[model samples]
Target: MNTPPHFGTDTPRDLVGIGIGPCNLSLAALAHPLAELDAVFYEQRPRFDWHPGLLIDGARIQVPFLADLVTLADPTSPWTFLNYLRTHHRLYPFYFAERFHMQRAEYDTYCRWVADQLPGLHFRHQVDAVRWNPEHDVFEVDHTQLDTHGEAEALGRTHTRNVVLGIGTEPYIPDALRPLVDAPGVPVVHAADYLTHRDTLLTAGHITVVGSGQSGAEVFLDLLRHRPTGHEQLHWIGRTDAFAPMEYSKLGLEHFTPDYTRYFHALPENTRDRLTTAQWQLHKGIDATTLAAIHDELYHRTLGGGWPDTVLTPGVRVRTAGRIATTKIELHLEHIQQNTRTRLTTDAVVLATGHRERSLDRILVGLDPYIRRDNSERPRVDEHFRLVLDPSVTATGCNIYLQNAERHTHGVGAPDLGLAAWRAATILNTLTGKETYPLPTRTAFTTFGLERPQPRVPAARQAAPTLTPLVDRR
Candidate 1:
């Protein structure tokens, strides 16, 4: 096979993406048909895998199938999920089954198919650092190729007119539970790795599921089904007041639309921070289906006129955790509503505490001095998804776009699958200065705030489809 053109030679590439997750993969798929664009994506893993650890057997993606890599931005694109089904010759079966939300494992498989066919994706290449070259007026990306054991075997560089970071997120282990996870003999594990340790966890006399999100509910439900009904010694607890269902009402979902993303970005930094904390249920709550399934499972177990030996408590926080001898875990707890404290010892604990956005500082350290920051010290991201770099850096005429890394600026939709294609299109539009993919003029009916004067260019409507001059890569 012929190798893709190498960057850093005679002419710089248009864009060099660092991390080939769904976000950048979307960008690559969308950018593929654009004739004037030249791009490459690098990933550290040997192959594409999205949330491999958390693809529990029957867990369905919250978003519908239309939220694929290219459909939302350009439904006609050949890379749509529907096309995947058609290509795999399962379109008729999919139609008969009538499942709008596909299973998590299936989605992971679909993503792998997309990644395999997409061009210019280099896996096993770890991007070590990115630096700006004032002389060449481009960004220099340093990377190391890894072998099977993940050790560096070769070094290379890429100079590009722009770069995109789609490094994605990391499993968030709270400070209180870190000791328990790191402690040798304990069976405490995050929900991200639940399937990997399922057998060992199920054999335990007692299992405690922590956190109240979808993963926690799914894990608890799975355990409920596997254990004997009469002796199911399971405990599920979290800091939330109750096992709350996610906000799935038609109107409530508008918060994820591009119109709302624009409105949210316009708010003051402090206001955005406050709103994120207040609107936890919008994205962090359990799906109604999963919640219902849990309730149904519990109800079925109670048909014998006796309650299953399962304990469920909410509004409870794990203050500390330790090993009880070498076989069990002891979790120190506190009640949020009432001034009460308690402790529980279990054979195993499953933490579904969720994930957090990874920091880009370590890789972008060389460009730190040239990067701009918000009041909270986070790199300021503009409406177009480009990092708000310093004037000096901007003067070099280079762009640094972000994917799934702008939650503070883009709101809950930052990591949402539904908005992935649209965000990718938006970044491409800004990069090539053209409407590479035509987007919808308006996506939501609700107006965010009428009082505040709107900008001349409405966020709801993108600029017209006019060809803009592209920056010469030479």
Candidate 2:
């Protein structure tokens, strides 16, 4: 096997991707087929680990398996769920199961398997910054490769015709718990790191989980199931009255459909902002299965003549969390209904708080003057998901596209797994003219050692195929 030469300053690549999350994974799969385009994805992790911490046992994806990274975008694409089943020899079992959704673990496994088959993906390469080289009409990416101890060893730089920002989301921690992060033995952790401390949390006499989303509920249930009898208690704290279920109606689920995203982008700016604020519960909410599990556990404990040490502190907000000692942490809670404040101590704190989109400022610092922002302070992107840059910088027919960074403009579907393959194809079509090459239907088959075949114009659509051009601010 030939090891691809290391990318450096002198060797200019067609594209350099900053992150290899599912979002960019889809892009890499699509770009691999375009022999004319040389692209590579730089991932910080040694290997792929998507939502590893929240892979609770028996937890299935809330979305259907059909909405996988590639299926919805390209059904015939090899990256489809069907291909995953076929490659794993589980096609018969999956068909017999007659299930549309799958366990979160299984989905993650599928993603990892696909990732392993894709080349030009540099693992353990963490990008530190991306600056636009106005003179050269390219991006200068600075990154460092980490060793086993997570220490940077090889410092390197690469220049690319364009850059795709798919850095994904950052775990959000509440302001109240910010202080506890530095305290000794505080055990203050976000839900993104739940698996790291699952055993410790299970052994703790008292555990408090803050947040009411899917992660929060999952953590609460996992703790309840794993804790030794009469040894530990779990408390679920949230701002909402109860675990709000995700909206899965035909029309509601449309929020994740491409057409809806287009509709959302066409709406007035004020209308889009209003929709996002009003529909926060739709995507940020928990699944019904998790809610039911909590309810069932409580009911079962009640039937056993006593309440298992569990409490749901809904409609309450944490005002502050501080370390009272090496072994305990104090939580100051404000009850919304009663208008009362109460103090509680816990052995450990699990912040089920969610995440926010990664900011582009971290990478494209030099191009900050060109990037536009929406009313909500997110990057303003066009329908094709390119950042609206200032007219001063020559775009060199090179476009900086975003994968998971356009939720505000594109709706909830922007960051979803369903749009992954479609977004990649969109970018590919935009970079290379419609007449350049036809897009292939199957995205999973092996081509030139790459996982997917190149995009080829269909015989029928060749004459009037849509043309997507690179953004030329010049």
Candidate 3:
């Protein structure tokens, strides 16, 4: 990148965001109306697109429409999803349809609409590094401006009092199957790129899906519907004992509320680790509707008094994988309960194993000395979502905030869509040292722990006293 003179002025901004995914987009939308706070967000992508490869047809997001960009925190904001529909003249049609959950594609479109109109959002700009400048008492942000083709055009620098990182997660592939996917002319692929290879996969002789989550279920169902009835040759397997439905009960869903998140944050480190693994069904299970659809499709094929040529076993996992004569794939499987082993061959494989949070070591390398880490070497995040840095850094009133990177400290709600608005509001309130957005005292019906949970209500606004005119009575 061509290094040019500094692009920003001597006056530092209040906040600088590193990534423009849904989390940072929510923060930008909420920060827009606060005239007192000056903030800007940067995104590497040329435009906003949420999970473009996974936008399957007829697939709906897990959360309701109310969990939009700004509705849960500030419904009156112009960036709300309702406002988007109103401006596009689709409110009446949406109302007449009576749909609570929106399709995945529509949600992507809604985000793009907001990204197109929102100001102070610099797209095609990639933040390179962040460091503390004690001399100026501000964070130095170095970024590279990219052209439409993602080539570096120029290098610029900005100074900010605080920084927030919202870089999102990446697709995860198992180690045993990574070689198969990396090899050329192989049909093994992760579900994140399923749509791009759907036609090629559908033409294969037999297909195998290696996950039990919503994405895996959706992929299997989509492929099943396309194949012929009697000739359908498919296999679905995972590590779970059974295909379980997500915990969607009204009371069970309290786990995703701010109350539970706070309670979980205060627990012992070992206890928190155990709960995260035990609560897999909360966020990593199939939807009931999708499971029912799969069963219905299978039942329809049995009208001729013969079962469909398919196999679905839950307690099985691929122990090893390799190529079979370069024409098919071989998988060595094991049943966890029975301790039995077998081998299966398929023409193609779809791995819907899910995603892992992108590491922050590269960008935050400059701030390593000040960052306080836990036993696992992970950054310690406080309840306010600020990283617990050394006193030398905090003494200058410069803070480093986080979003969606606090799952270990905050709980599973760190990645939930329902908590995005609330978290953004909390971060803003903490940054400005005032209640920029008023949050609720309570959100869930159930109290999480025996110890009384603390109320998160913002401190009462300190209004100036009204003085009456001094009269003769004085």
Candidate 4:
């Protein structure tokens, strides 16, 4: 195996990555070979973790194992799921288990293992700000290092030719739940922190789970199954009519495939928006296992010959929730059909609401004047994933690329594991002026896989003309 190159303290690097999520993990793997170009990945966490809060012991990945960080884009790459299994000596046992998809914990372990093998990864480094330096045509990044006491007290700086920002999603709590975030002794928390307070909530007298997505349903089912027989009650409320299952058809799953992203990007703006709105159910829907778990809990309670303390109220919106005391919470809800409001008291309220993309406002403050925006107020990106800069800005062939930040322009595959490797290679190609990072080769008999590599077009067919008729006339 070839070792990655390193730079001296004074040597300038080619690029600096803001976060070390799976998106940039793929980039680090692909960019490893560019020895002349120095790169470093900064992560705020003390170690590698991908959605650690949601890595329930029995929870399986929504997508297949083959759709890992790099497999679909680079099957032969060492970072493939098969390679991960082989490296960990679990391939045979995994096959014997007869499971197509392993638990989310296992998947997360694989990612962390891969991250451990990679170099140039800096942890405990939280980027505080980024400023554009026009004179040097580079970005100046300011970061702080957390000390033993968890206080950020040390400051550092680095200059790079370009930067790739992949600061993942932020938990999205409803506006009404904002007050409860800092309330004293209020057992109100988002689903992302479920595991942190699972024991407390499970033992509570009455628990109400808000939202109807996968997280909400999972929390409700888990609580319903584990809570004491007659002491605890479980209540679920959502805007939808029961938890809807994700679309699992071959064609429906294609929305996260590269082909679908290409097709979606080629469509007109209005048509693309229409398609996205129409297909929200494909990705936003919950898992069937969660719904079935809820059903089983209900069936078990019915067989006991007594009414169980569990309620499922669909199409209801939470109007307000207040902490009545140190131990209880009051919720005001309005049902869609009843058109009348009602109130309920519960020991805990778990908001299983989803997440939204992190806003780029703070870090990109200096570059905001130069960055172009699309109709949705998101940054406009070029085909190479570079931010579309204003004409006034100039560079020494430097380009700021983005990963997991172009959901509107790139479609569903923007934040998915399927596209990570490809996006990284695209950025590499734009930077190196050559296709040096080739994807790994795979054999035909792989259980779950994409089609073989496609033929590359010749230079003439791929190149864009430098002098157009209008330019010549001018």
lDDT of each: 0.89, 0.79, 0.90, 0.78
Best by TM-score: 1
Total colliding residue pairs, candidate 1: 0
For candidate 1, write residues 1-474 as lDDT tens digits: 113336347678889999988898899899989878888899998889888778887899999999888998988988999999999999999999999999988888888888898888988889999999887788999988888899998788888999999999989999999998887886888998899999989989999999999889999999999999888999999999999999999999999899999999998999988988899999989999998888899999889899989999999999998997799899999999996999999999999999999999989999998888998899999999989988877877798999999989879889999899999999998888777777788899898888766668766787778888999999
Q: Residue 217: error of model 2 in Å? A: 0.6
> Across residues 38-139, which tens digit of lDDT does each residue of candidate 3 receive?
888888888887988789888889889998988888888998899999999999999998999888899999988888887788888899999898889889
Ranking by TM-score: 1, 3, 2, 4
Models sorted by lDDT, best on top: 3, 1, 2, 4
Q: What is the C-alpha lDDT profile of model 2 across 101-163, one tens digit per residue?
A: 899899899888878888888888888987777777777888888887889978888888778
Model 4 local distance difference test score: 0.78
Model 4: how far residue 255 lies from native, Å: 0.7
- How close to the true structure is residue 285 of candidate 4, measured as C-alpha lDDT? 79
Q: Which stretches of candidate 3 lie over 4 Å from their true place?
A: 1-8, 452-474
Error of 1 at 117 (Å): 0.6
Q: Report the Cα lDDT for candidate 2.
A: 0.79
Candidate 4 runs further than 4 Å off: 1-11, 230-232, 268-275, 392-395, 437-474
**In model 1, where is the ten-residue run with the lowest total lDDT?**
1-10
**Residue 415 accuracy (lDDT) in model 1:** 90
- Candidate 1: pairs in clash: none
